[model samples]
Target: MNTPQQTESIKNLVENIDKGNIVLPEFQRDFVWEIKKTCELFDSIVRDIFIGSIIYGKPTFEITVREIDTRPRKGQGSRRKLKITSFDKGEINQKSQISNFRLILDGQQRATSFYRALKGIDEIWFIAKSEDDLDNEIKTKEYKDRSLEEMLYTFSLQEDEERISIKLSEAYEISKGDMFDEDIKENFFDNLLFVVAMNDAELKDNFRRYKTLCMKLGELFKSELLLSYYLLNMDNEKFALFFERSNSKGIQLNFIDILAAKLYKGFNLRDKIDELESRYPNFKFDREIIVRTISYIVSNGKDIDRNYILSNLNYDHFNLYWDDICKYYNQVLDFLFQEDLAISQNWMPYENMVIPLIIFLRESNQNDFSQMNEWQYEFIKYWYWASILSQRYSSGSNEAILQDSNVLKSIAKGIKITDRVFFTRLKSQIDSYEDIFSYSRKVNVIYKGILNLINYNSMGLTDWNNSSKLSFSKKLEDHHIFPKEYIKQQFKNDEQAISLMDCVANRTLIPKITNIKVGKKKPSRYMTELKASNEKLDSTLKEHLVPTEIVEGLYDEFFNEFIEERAKLIFDLIKKTIIEKEKQIIDQYYLAPRVQGNIKIFATYYSKKLEATLDVDSQKVLLLGESHSVSSAADKAKYTLSGKGDTSTNGWRFWKYIDNNGQERYIDEFRK
Candidate 1:
């Protein structure tokens, strides 16, 4: 058993395992050898495909060891497929090679599965028309990525003599429930076509398949699991290191997967996860979210620390509070959908964003959004947008969420939440961003979040008819301000110009109709028409909060200026949007909410050529003699500047507007 052989014949290995020469190390997990997985290995062995190799670690020092669970546990419901469960730990009387016993550091599960098949303890069989079909299947078996009850078959191994040739009828009988009654299994053939032509040669050919496959597969079965062994003889001090190194090269079990196993015994995490997934037929969450949710709840809403997530907590409490976990999770889903947090799953930049909210809900005993105050809603709203613009949860496990999870517990309790902080730490992190182009991969989620904000801002945008608030059902695609087609024509040789088309400043979410109708047209041309036709069109466009830097009679030659100008303007617009969103977010969101009158302010500059003062409230310049938005206000103000105004005079950029305190400030200050 201590022999350091690189390879062993399949027959010899199986026999040795049956005789208890090979044993699993104490560190190994129990045989959770799935039936379908075993069958898959059987199929590959039949094709003589190299499934994989195994590692056996033998200790140089004497160590006590017990025989592995070759036999099934007698009364355990999950172990029915296993044989001879009646063996006892005391019967560990099998001298078991004592210290010289080889421990399967890797491939223990696989080896045991193949061993069962060869010993006729658990017969694994597959149906194929010929050896060629088996060969073709092994080469293309990646499609069976899910559970095992696939093209292979499994039957009871009552006796070794009958193990190789299983009757189709008996295979069906021995299988539990209607397990063999799958649609694929419906084509189970006494003949290849599944059409029974009694006495037909083709039909007779089908009957030979099981026996033929069994005989051929049985020959390779030993060799398949009989893979080359990487044997190491290490002392106890290095055994663990060698075992880890030996298994590290292969697919390692995920920490989360191990966590699921570490939960209370008999806690069917898989079945529970399936139930939760099926609960939302339309929106299924991934397992990590649920696992984190459980961790948050079990810890009483503190933090989803990795160590806690991977350990088994009190089962009594788990059993007691299980329903509450489901309640909090479902409530989380409902809240996200209610808020329209995501246009679709793709728009959801970070699933981790929901962790803090759900943790608060679970800890606060608050299951519904009704418990959320206006301030909380506003805070959450701001947090959501801030998260996107700042990419707050971009990292897998952000400390902010964990930090917020603790703060949320207090806030959820109707405790007057302190404005001591929010996004301040993120400010420097955010400032580090030199620029975010529309084309940046990181900006995609942020852009989508911006789109949602635009559509929802101030009663949303008007539909094509200008009849009603746009419906959420309609998709708003990223629109180029200076159309890419038109821009391409302007800078034909500049590839960077094309790449800059994705700039966040240049991109805005607009109605498909607006996006299409405005296609391939210079902004000054089409927009002038649009500004003239609809009295509310200016406001509608402004509602978008994008930098609308257009004025009449400036274009064809202004393409480069458009990008540079729009880039600055759009950046300013983002700052302004963040300002407004900050108000909705929390107290720390830009020094609490700054409320202003509905009246729009225009930026007015003094005309040095004339000593004239314009009344700001009228939305008019005395020189212009009419009401105007900020842009028009600037036009008149510029005229007063030098008895003339050039195309360079941008009113939006020019005017200094009053804040809530009635103190005048430039639009540029907010951009800071």
Candidate 2:
């Protein structure tokens, strides 16, 4: 076995530019450092604080970095030599002289950040604070209230043909909203007039603060930046292993990142996720779902720990099924939309639910649920609400998934499920309308779920503005029933006041235009504005699920009574909607027991062909005494006729009619 070589070396900003030996690998992500962080990094370096280490692999051949995406070039790969060159903003450049390169396995971000700041790429600077002035600032609390750049002298050394001009500047624009009464720049350079050119005869004193700051900055540049590096021999496999483990302190390496490095494809898994995510812009594709999904099917319902998942996975296993996973998972997304479960992947309360969902859907019946029965739909609904209302996936997530995956697998195989504990537990929960802030501007799972329930149930809000369509998703803003001011007046403690003011029961999504008109008014006062017709206000209130009778004279009732009564009303509304609407969805859309005695049509090269007789009650089509579901029957006919599956054949074209002397058609139509 060949042992890997490891070592450490220090390199300064000048050496990095002059040699250009350190370069990032193609696997490294793009640089995203902002100007503020650049300032902090430069300050840490000048104060001699340790930033961290960089790891490098000494390869046989140096590879150029992918061209950085920026305004100069719009995300295009660069063919340039990719070496850093030394050039002052106003002066000529010097080319690098060294040849041997170190492929950066880690710390590419830190290096790029340093390069940008040192090169003044984004106009970041180091604060040149003297020891005495720094102490004075700390004592006066100047450092506390003001930015480092504002309280102290900051300079950038710009060199021309002859001498370096030490220019004074302020970083107030880049400062994080910290302003000082006194302008540090006013008469800042007064003492430094020709201080560099002054002889001993013309010098006022060499101890002037600005002169000392310039001297410190000039000396600081010559010193090397501290960077600890592990020097590894050229090996792609070893480099990948090190890179995956390198980010243990931060966000650990995702399976996609490791898989990409292992697979070495033209486009990475992230790009594929991006492509899938683009197809459904409203939904966020959780990377863990992708990994867990692949793991679930590959393991055949067995559970795997997060850390060991990548180790067990091989390139062949992923490549073979990745494309199918992408397609089938998209169908899963479409299924979610069809179900109306109040799920937004972006604001999902329990994203863990999606893992088992995709796995079960992908595992069952040719990786789709289009031919599903009524019981399957009911099971899916129960699975969704059970996972949501109960904390089934929140704790012991691995154990829960393992158990749930087994149950779902059994169901998909047409096995009878007698167990009902999970669904029963979810249904038994009496505590609904849990407290969530109305003051929140962000869309959370609870709020989004509430809105989804309303929309799915088709219960439109009663409003003064007349409109045919209820565009609630865009039109609604969260409205507080009890104004914050009223709540504040009711409670002596400020914190207690806000708790009642922002609670979920006190809020509802109403039209934004109405919200603007109502603007901070008490709910009692605005109640009249919500009534559109002569219908009693209480009747309208039931439609919106507002606790009108309780909130009408809410001032009379104590705050606690108000909360309790409104919470009960909200709970009842949710319970009624979910329980009743589910039956409606099943009764109207259930296709398992589809209507029978209809003529079935199939697409052909010349014309239509009758394939099978529909027996909707049995949920099967009979062809030559062979039973098949609607779609499968059509597939069988097309395949037997042409040796191909014409999946595009419209199965819904089945028609029932008395025709001109109508008798049963299907197989008889071909005889005609």
Candidate 3:
């Protein structure tokens, strides 16, 4: 039997492959063909098979070869696919109709080898009539000979009837001839052949065997096991849908979603209150406590308004007493987790308390609680509520027990054992309460109390002692009480001697030199000077002090009324100091300014002239009397910038005084 021409046979096999008529599953990874390896493989086959002129079917093969497709299908689990395309019988016809020939699967390597061999050259290798040694049917006396004869008969027979008995194998073995290099056995021959293929059944039975072979040879010869396909291959809509499905991981989880999930998972509350809380993210923090407490409260069919219960209690109360509540929660969660405790609703009752309670439990150092007092526990609870409700009223971690002494004092005053018990009881008392209302009221109370303590005037103006080596007299200062501008405004109505003299309310004990420098500048402009002078002041106060820390702490508002109240307090203190100073002078000397009223007589001289001048009335007084009479207009009281006493006619002779009460007095005559 004469097989068809090799070209016609190979053409039929190529057609079969293109039409998907032949299914070749990948037995290794996808085509990783290096151009260099392909070149080498091509050169080897040409040198060994074509050049040697040995008919391909004869054994004693030193090199091995195989062929497998490298493309992958979508969703196939393996990383490699394999197919057979050639055999030992003959080369395939490249143009023959594949449907007409019974393709013996073993020749895939041979066909590929022959095709690549012929493709690189201008002429294809053909068996010549001159190589007559193996052309005749010479019988060898062995069973191997019979098997070889049987195999050859399958392809040699020209008639279909004679080919029927040949048992065709699905794989082929080929020789390296003299082309096998020891170093290239694994790197070249084994990789290109045996490692390239394993049928599906063969792979399942012996994946270890082929995987090891691939490991030794190289990955290039292995078929693609994992199938990967891109959405771009599909139509627009399918492409979009596929992309969306693949790109689902792109959406970022927001903080709330992430935090909520953590709370839900860590405590196993998915079916419990977390499910309900998921419906409204805004109420998550409040629901952290309310839902579980409500579930626990309502389990026994008690009629209570959820809103009313939350409204009366306030977050402060909860913060102070959440631990006690969690003790009850732990019982509930432990029961739920272990025994599936009977809950009021099909709702997972355990979740409500576990999330926040577990959070608290983990936050609290268990061993240290033994030494903690009731007050400490209450303080911790208050801070917790403060953090959860107002998003942290005091500084530090959300769970830190407030260590600031002032904060501790403020919170301690607000939360008492009585208030704690009452709110807990109130949880059961009210028909409906809002968590937000309770939370707001609690925060408002705490914030207001803190503000009050900060603004309290018990420290008084004396606290501005500047004991830290700070001094207004030297450092430059201004009155914070009633500014000079305010005095000027009031001065518009009253310019009388008393009114023009700065009013008691207008007085402020400040750095003296600075006050003198500022003089009558508008308070707004002077304020900039004052702020610039005080580097120790907080930057917020660098522009304005009255509305800064002092006023911000002292008054809820810095409007006129509040300013007036602070002014009154300040002026009262100033007036008392001025009165005491006047009394001291009066008790010391009758000639000095009287503590009786705001008046004092003083003497002066103008060059050679004598005059008794009434100098401006200030906190300080200077008095002088002279011999000049009331009727003497010639010497109309010339005043001199003289000190306590003058040597010109003795200091008293230069000035005279007529008392306001009609008492006439001369300086020298009175002294005599």
lDDT for model 2, please. 0.48
TM-score of 2: 0.43
Candidate number that wins on lDDT, 2 or 3 = 2
TM-score of each: 0.42, 0.43, 0.15
Which structure is stronger by TM-score: 1 or 3? 1
Report the lDDT tens digits of candidate 1 across residue range 132-174.
Answer: 1123334233322312223232332211111123432334333
Which one is best on TM-score? Answer: 2
Cα deviation of 282, candidate 2, in Å:
4.7
Model 2, 1-672: lDDT tens digits are: 164533342225335534555555565775655334554455445434455666656654334444222221111221123433333322211212244445567766666665554444444434343222243334334222434333333322221111112332222221212433233223333233333333332233322333444444544444455453445652333344455445766866644576666555543666767787787665566666666667776776554545445566665666676777776666776666555454234434566666666656665756577777776676776556545544344334664676566556555655543323223333413344433222133334344555445444544444433433334234556666665666666564645445556666666656667667766555666555555433366754555556666436664335556655666665565667454455553343223322345444333321334445655445456776788755466557656654554333223223222222122222212211
Better of 1 and 2 by TM-score: 2
Worst 10 residues of 1 by lDDT: 155-164
Clashes of each: 9, 0, 70
Every candidate's lDDT: 0.51, 0.48, 0.30
Best by lDDT: 1
Identify the runs in model 2 with alpha carbons over 4 angstroms from their true place.
1-256, 366-370, 418-479, 489-498, 509-518, 530-544, 549-559, 573-672
CA RMSD (A), model 1? 33.7
